[model samples]
Target: MEPQLLHTVTGQVATVVIRHPAKRNAMTAAMWGSLPPLLETLAADPGVRVLVLTGEGGTFCAGADISTLRGSPLEAQRLAVAAEEALAAFPGPTLAAVRGHCVGGGAQLAAACDLRFAEEGARFGVTPAKLGIVYPSSATRRLVSLVGPATAKYLLFSGELIGTERALRTGLVDEVLPAGELNGRVAEFTGILASRSSLTQAAAKEFANGRTDRDAHWEERARESGDTSEGVAAFLERRTPRFS
Candidate 1:
């Protein structure tokens, strides 16, 4: 069967599932091409507050579909890079709920996400070295930012897969859960994110992702949003803050 990128929205959370189980959810060029527009559509929806990216079947993405590499390799790489950029640039919080193999381009997609929750058996690697290809500079920078230059170099240079424990220790994954607990934990966390103030989250996300300049309108926007006041009121009333 052909590879597919499937999406669904439930309340404030949107999920993008990589479905190519025959190749361990390996991403095809077409799947890469589809990502940016899919993310854009989700971003435009006011109801969607967070995105969850995962794979169907037992495993996460393996990498670029090697079959496509025999055709237009450069185009496949370009599309993959574009998709990675789109995920990295997503305005809202994004999480990767990973299991099994997440290697090469799959690792890139996970790195692009804000957080990653992985099953204990999950494996991660960056393997362009094995294929005699250059990993994109943006992806390299993002990987370095996540796990530092030395560790990033270790993975890129060796093309060796690491277990979930090493991934967590290296900061590649935020949390490690049992295979059965992964989805529930992710849903629980995203629910918390969705219930919080979007304005605050957006501002924090921007600043945390290396926005050095002060956003001049931040204070004004915050004040107008009334989130602080609502938060304070909620605290006093001992009720959940209703963020619009």
Candidate 2:
């Protein structure tokens, strides 16, 4: 069987490719099943500073592999929930490099990431409406967290695939680059992130995640942490922080 998840480290940056391009990179249950452990491996490696998720070929993802999703509805539910939870809780920063079709569970996976960089031709949608399956609540929350409740409702209710500009207007993507520029831009962005102090990066992710839910003292406490002090000092001295 072909491996569903492909992981490799290039210096401080880690790359994960969903390797089913023969099917527009649609994820099978097994693919989703393997992601958490792979992400955990990167998370535990102190050497890894950044993670990027992409699909082989020009497509980002076409969502769930409904071909194998036959009569086992309960099994399908379990897999979907477990798959999304794994991505949602992955430690360290992650970016989804998107190009062609990004629909259904593929969109959920991207929604789990900290950032999404889409190619100009990328199309995004939450497609449970067409599939007759409910969009899991956790996935819904993540989508709403990105683009607000109304926009989330719009995508969920309509099963509509949107253009890159519409996605950007709704904050579904951080950057949209031309197809020729997508790979290089993703490398450039993650390269910058890789050079930042990991301790600061991890702490900042935690702090920002809390801020979205209206966590109090998150900012104040983070600013008081040793990592923050080191970051400020590094900036003042025009040097990189050596966060321990």
**TM-score of each model, in listed order:** 0.97, 0.89
- Residues 121-240 of candidate 1 have per-residue lDDT tens digits of 999999999999889999999999999999999999999999999999999999999869998999999999999999988888889889858687778888898989999999999999
Worst 10 residues of 2 by lDDT: 211-220
- State which candidate has the highest TM-score: 1
Whole-model lDDT, candidate 1?
0.94
Question: Clash pairs of candidate 1?
Answer: none
lDDT tens digits, residues 18-68, model 2?
888678888887887788788788888988888898988888889888876
